[model samples]
Structure formats: C-alpha cells, structure tokens
Target chain A: MRMDKEVVNPIIDTILGSITSGLNSLQASMEPYLPELSWVAYLAFAIYVLIILAGGFMSILCRNLVRAMMGLVLTFLGVAGMYLLLASPFLAFMQLLIYVGAVCVLIFFAIMLTRNVSDGEEAHWPTLGALGYGLLALLAPLGVIGPLIIMHAGKIPVQVPVENPTGELGEGLLSDYVLPFELISIILLVAMAGAVYLAFRGFGPEKSKRHSK
Target chain B: MTTLTFFLLASLLLLAIGLAGLITRRTLVGMLISVELMLNGAGLSIVAAYKSTAASDVLGQLATLFVMGLAAAEATLVLAMILVVHRRFGKVTTKEISLLR
Candidate 1:
C-alpha cells in the first residue's frame, strides 16, 4: 500500500496543482470585478447549488436504490453548507449528524433488508413518456409561474444578518420553546419503540418455532 | 440575485423537484426520499425567511431544529414500516403491494 501511494502521490499532486493554478489564474483575470474574498463565498454557494441539483435529479431518476440514497446524502450535505452560509452553524452540524449520518445509514439498511423484494418488481427506469409527463406535470408549470411571481413580488428589504444566533437559539429553546423541545424527545422515543415493535412484531417464539419447522 | 432571493428560489426549486419525484417514483423508499427533499426545502425556506425578515429572532433556527427532529423520527418510522410491508407483502414497490385492489 505504501509503495502504491508513493507512485500515485505525484500524479495526485500534479492534478491538484493544475486545478488550483487554473482557479488562481481565473480569479486573477476576474479580480477587477469580483475583487476579494466575496467571490469565494459565491463560488462555494454555486458549488452547493450544483451539488443539490445533481443529487436531487439523481435521487429521483436513478435506477439503483443505493445510488439514490447516496444522492440524497449529497443533497443533505449541500443543504448543510447552505445552512452554514445562512449563518447557522449549529443547524448545519445537526444536518450533517442527523440527516447525512443517521438518516442515510438507516435508509441504506432498509435498502439492504428489502433488496429481494424490489428485484423483479416494477423497478425499471422511467420511460421517456413518463419523464415527459413528469416534466409537464410539475416542472413546466412551476418553472413558468415561479419566475413570474418572484419578478412581480416586491423584495423584502434585507437586514444585517446575525453573525451567531446559536446561543440565542439555545436560550430560546430552553425558555420560549421548552414545551416543543420536550415533546420532540417524547416523539422520538415513541418512534423508536414503535419502529422496533413494528419491525419485530411477528417474530414471537411460537411464530419462530412454526417457521423453523 | 440577493442571498435571500437565491435561497428562496432554490428552496422553491427543491420543492418542485421533490414533488415531481414523489409523483414519478415507483418504490416506497423512493417516495420517502422525495418527502425528505420536500422537508429540506421547507426548512431552508423557513430559515431564509427568518434571516431576511427577522435577523435576530431565534424562532427560525428553533423551527428548523424541530424539523430535523421530526425528519429523524419520520425516517425511523417510515423505514420500519417499509420493512414490515416488505415482510408481509413480499414486495416493496408501490404497484406490487396493492392488496385491496
């Protein structure tokens, strides 16, 4: 492994060097207009948007369920970056820990458990007719109407964003939103119990014995 | 476009994509994934709304926290239900499990 890494390291370094150099050249060329670290934020935002779009499209259109889950994971990560851009690092971390970490793993497990069930089912890719219908059904109307509304609507005046609201968020959760906070815990507990029960409801001793015969 | 506008538009797009997926997906798990996308869109829009309209208010962050909690719970329950359905019906696709019809 060490020898392989030694051989591959130079190639990886060369690729990375070229990419960074290319970006630097592009930034230098655009320096007069963009001029500073602001463009980096925009670049990051654009990358996140691309990830979201690609991941969402892949999740919807992919034939493989596991690949679809991976796409969903990408969407989660992109949304976490969006949260960071929105000045909420706490929620961004939660998005990473819960959505990408926990939820995606859970979905992966479900995919593994149910693999045989989906094998011979109507699990094919959407045909061109279905794709066209889906586009017409949702995308066309939303695409046409969404821009019209946004263009006509008066913009909400932007305020100076809070630099860090996580502390205030905690205080509010403890004081103003305490009830809902506690309720969420209870809901999670109930869900956990319910899920376990639902999954193993029929695996009683007698049923297991019957199946064994 | 302004950051606020960009987020709103992106969230709207996410919603439309999610809904389209929900309509077009053939598997129960795929539908669950679509619902998650819709929820993320809702969370982003909420945070963006609060960021632009009420920068100091912690309500938006709190609401998003609640959303994440609910999403975790929903994923748990839905995946479990999917397992049950697969066990009982021996299939996990939408078209194959129609017992009533």
Candidate 2:
C-alpha cells in the first residue's frame, strides 16, 4: 500500500508539471499583443508621418528649387516632432535650431551663390520615366527585406518613463563621451575653415576661365 | 503595428526614399538633399530604438548628437564643394563633373 501511494504521487506530479507548462505557454502567447494606442494617438502618428511624406515628396519631386528647400524645412520640422514624440524634447529643439535655423540657411546661401546654374530652367519637374524608375528602386529593397523583419518583429518591450534625459545626456556627454564631443568640435572647425576657403576663393582668374562655357 | 514598429517602418521608408532619390537624382545639390534625408532617417531610428528598447539609457541620444554633428560637417563641406564645382564646371549635373572619364 505504501509503495502504491509513492508511485501514484510521482505520476500525479509529472502530469501537473506538464499541465502547468502548457498553461504557462498559453498565458505567454495571450499576453497583450495590442499596443495601448488610442484613436487620437494613432491619428497624431498618421499626421506626423503624412507630414514627413509630403516633405519627402516635395523635396524629391518638385520642379521649383525654392519649393524643394521648403520641403526640406518641412521634413526637418516633422523629424523634430517625431523626436518630441519619442520623448527626447531636447533633441527635438536641437533639430529645429540646427537643421531649420542653420543648415537650411546655409543651403539657401549656397543656392543663392550658385543661382545662375542651380536655380534656372533646370528646375523643371522630374519626368514620369524617372519617377517610375525611382519608385521601382525604392520598392525593391523594401520588398526583399521587409518581410523577414516583420516575421521577427517580436514583442515590444515595456517602456520606462524617463523624467530628465537632458540632464543625463549632459552628464554622459561630459563624462563618457567627452572625447568624441571634442573631436566633433574640431571637425566642425575644420569644415568651417574648408568651406570658407572654398566659397571665398570664388570666381578667380584661373577658375573663371574654366567656367566660361 | 505597434508604435515602435510604426516608427521603425517609417524610418525605413524614409531611408528607401532617400536611396531612390540618390540613385535617380543627377544634380549635385539634389543628391546632397537626398543624403540628408537618409541621415535624418538614421537619427530617427536611433531615437526610436532608445525609446523602445533602452528607455533608461541616454547613449542613443548621444549617438544621435554625433550623427547630427557629422551631418552638419558633411553638408558644409559638400555645399562648399558644390560651390567650387559650379565655379569650375559651369554646371552642377553629375554627368558634367566626371573628371575620371
């Protein structure tokens, strides 16, 4: 009778272990696959993406050079918005200050400086053939690579709320990333010097002769 | 799709558009703008990754800062070079500036 009891208990425990694992698997699979996005949040995301799409379209497909530059500005703004949504407000501000205020201005300066060549009748719209080819080129990689990524997209991790990324960013910048930051500064100086040298050299005697055509 | 995946896909689309533009654009300035689009896509992806995977970490944001700096430097030098190109070649199309040919 004791032997019979021991044997039956071992069998029962084995059955319970398997059942528990099966239930665990079921629970894991049922873990909320739906992201907690409301309709409003979804709409906001769609609008931001649309803004980026419009900007990209204008930048690439527009006939007018000025319009293309405006599109670039729009794209920058949309990216800044995206950064804000991603919880990096400082990055959003930096994107605005740097891309919109500085880079676009510099680009406009270059455009004006080379207006005779860059801003002329060559501003005509891209041909349908070109657009078709561009679209084909655009879709090829997405077709080949996108499916595999989707298959393995996996579950999204829980997001941690970060209160002050800026302060942390500053601390990390000064401590761990100080060297790279200094190097970037040096590179900026070099780029500035080089740009000035190139731009100010201008239509000099030797070069103007070559551009006479 | 979830928000994270949506952002990733959007960034990917931007990258694809940039690639297409780079391939089809014959003009120097247009190509530069396309490259800028690609850089923007990269930064967005980095920021998104930080948001989704490592929300507690600031390293991704730091990387993005460096990316921005590099992009700025690239744009400056390229625009300067474009200016010089216009001065030398009388045109800004890629077909004209192929010195190797």
Candidate 3:
C-alpha cells in the first residue's frame, strides 16, 4: 500500500514550490517600502557620527597625552564604523587595519620614547597674552568662513549617482589615476627612508648618555 | 534624518575638536593625536560621500585604503621626527623645543 515514488516526488515538489512562492510574495510586498530602510541607515549613521565627535572631544579635552591618543584611536574606530554604515566595508576594514593597527602603535611608541609620562610639569609653550592673540587669530578665519559655508550650503548639489562606483574607481585608478598612484608610492618610499635615517642618527649617543646618567 | 547630513555634522564636529586640540595642546604627541583626529574626520566624510553617490561596493573602500596607507606613512615620519626631537632636547614638551627663537 506504499505510494509510488513518482507521486511522492510530485507532492514534495509542490510543497517546496508553494513555500518558495509564499516567501517570494512576502518579499514582493515589502519591496514597495524599500526607501523607508534609509531611516534605519540614517540612525546608524547618526550613532557612529556621535561616537566620532565624542572621541574627538575627548582627545582634545583630556590632559594626559596617552589618554588623548586613546581618544584618537576611538575616533578612528568610530569613523570606521561610519564607513561600514556608508556601505564601504572595504574602507572600514582598511581603516581599522592601517590607522588603528599601525598608526596608533607608532604614536604610542613615539610617546613612550619621547615623553616622561609620570612627570607632572605643565607643557604650555606660550604666555597667556600670546595664547589669547593666537586664539583670536584662529577664530577670525572661522568667523569669516563659517557663515560663508553655511550660506552657500543650500546652493550646493549634494547628491551624485555612482554606477558601481567601486568598480569604476578601480578602473579609474588603474587607467586614469595610475601615474598619481605610482607617484604616491614613490613619495611613501622616500618618506620611509627619511624617517629611518632621522630616527637612527643620534640613537647611539643618546643611549650612551642615558646609560651614564 | 539623512545619513549625509548626519555624517557631515559629525565630520564638522570632529574637525573642530581636532583644531581645538592642535591649538591648545602643548605636547608634540598631543598635537599629533589631534592631527590624526582631523584626518579621520576627513576620511569619514569621503566614505560617506562615496557611499551616498556611488552606491558601489569597492570604490569608497579603495579610497579609504589609500587614506589608510597615507596615514601610516605620515605617522611613521611624524613619530620618527618626534623621537629625534626628544633625543636632541631630552624632553618632548613643546615648551622646551623652541630653539629657533
């Protein structure tokens, strides 16, 4: 009394097809509201933005240089998160890998080598009157430029449609921007050599002096 | 409500804070940290622009990769300079290294 294999196969196929159709219809119904998804995207963007700002504020306000570096690292991470929200996961990954992983380490090493972190002396370089003048000088440009930028904001076009921009970017870089790219590499190599030479110059004398001290 | 506006505001705030740090901080390392903050702010803006306009997978990413490379190279050079300054002066305080005057 067992059902034929052919009958069972048809029954299974029908069941699976019906389930798929149901899911497809559900997705189709949801398609009309796709633009609303931008709200969620906006929220994610806002949160990351806040994180970055907060980190920047901390970096500035903190008295300890090490704490300031930590804040900078946090800011970089927040920016990376924002990159992810912007749909540039590749940039986000590179941000983490290069800035957080390498640059921060270099900053820390420099801090360790250069500063006596435990020393409690103030590090201000300018007299109060000079600092006041400097602040005024700095603020003057912002006062002039800020309003101009704000007023012109409405006139600026904000949106540009990119067609598979990442792919196009690769093509553009390899094809059109190739020379600049190569030049950047050469500059980096020069910088690397210069840094090595500068760092090695007085290390021996300084180390011996420190040992004798 | 727009991601673009949100990101723009964030970058602006970041830039402002970094600028403040650069102006006020007396330690070379602190100024360097502030510069890093400013760079990150710039990078965020670029990524946001790419994401909104290009809607592409890799273009924004590639730009950021270049930024990262540049940041690394910059950091290495700056850190080396900082170390050299420290060795020559026996201190990294901005106050102590003003021999040019």
User: What TM-score against the true chain A does chain A of each candidate get?
Assistant: 0.71, 0.72, 0.64
Error of model 1, residue A81, in angstroms: 1.0
Off by over 4 Å in 3: A1-37, A118-150, A153-170, A203-213, B54-64
lDDT of 1 at A41: 71
Q: What is the per-residue lDDT of model 2 for residues A13-128, given as tens digits with 9 covering 90 to 100?
A: 99988987876666466457635544445567778899999998887776566677789888888889888777789998989988888878767776666673345634665678
Candidate 1 — what's its lDDT? 0.81
Candidate 3 Cα deviation (angstroms), residue A164: 4.7
Best by DockQ: 1
Docking quality class, candidate 1? medium
* Candidate numbers, best lDDT first, in rank order: 1, 2, 3
Q: If scored against the real structure, what TM-score would every candidate get? A: 0.81, 0.81, 0.73
> Which residue pairs of candidate 3 clash?
A166-B59
| Alpha carbon deviation, residue A144, candidate 3 (Å) | 5.5
lDDT of 1 by residue, A1-213 (tens): 356877899999999999878888887887654424354677887998999999999888777777788889889989998888877888899999989988888888878888822443436867788777777656764777578647844455655346565678788989989999999999999999999999888787777775676
Query: DockQ of each model against the real complex?
Result: 0.55, 0.43, 0.43
DockQ of prediction 2: 0.43
Q: Tell me how far the alpha carbon of residue B16 in candidate 3 is from the true structure, in angstroms, after superposition.
A: 0.7
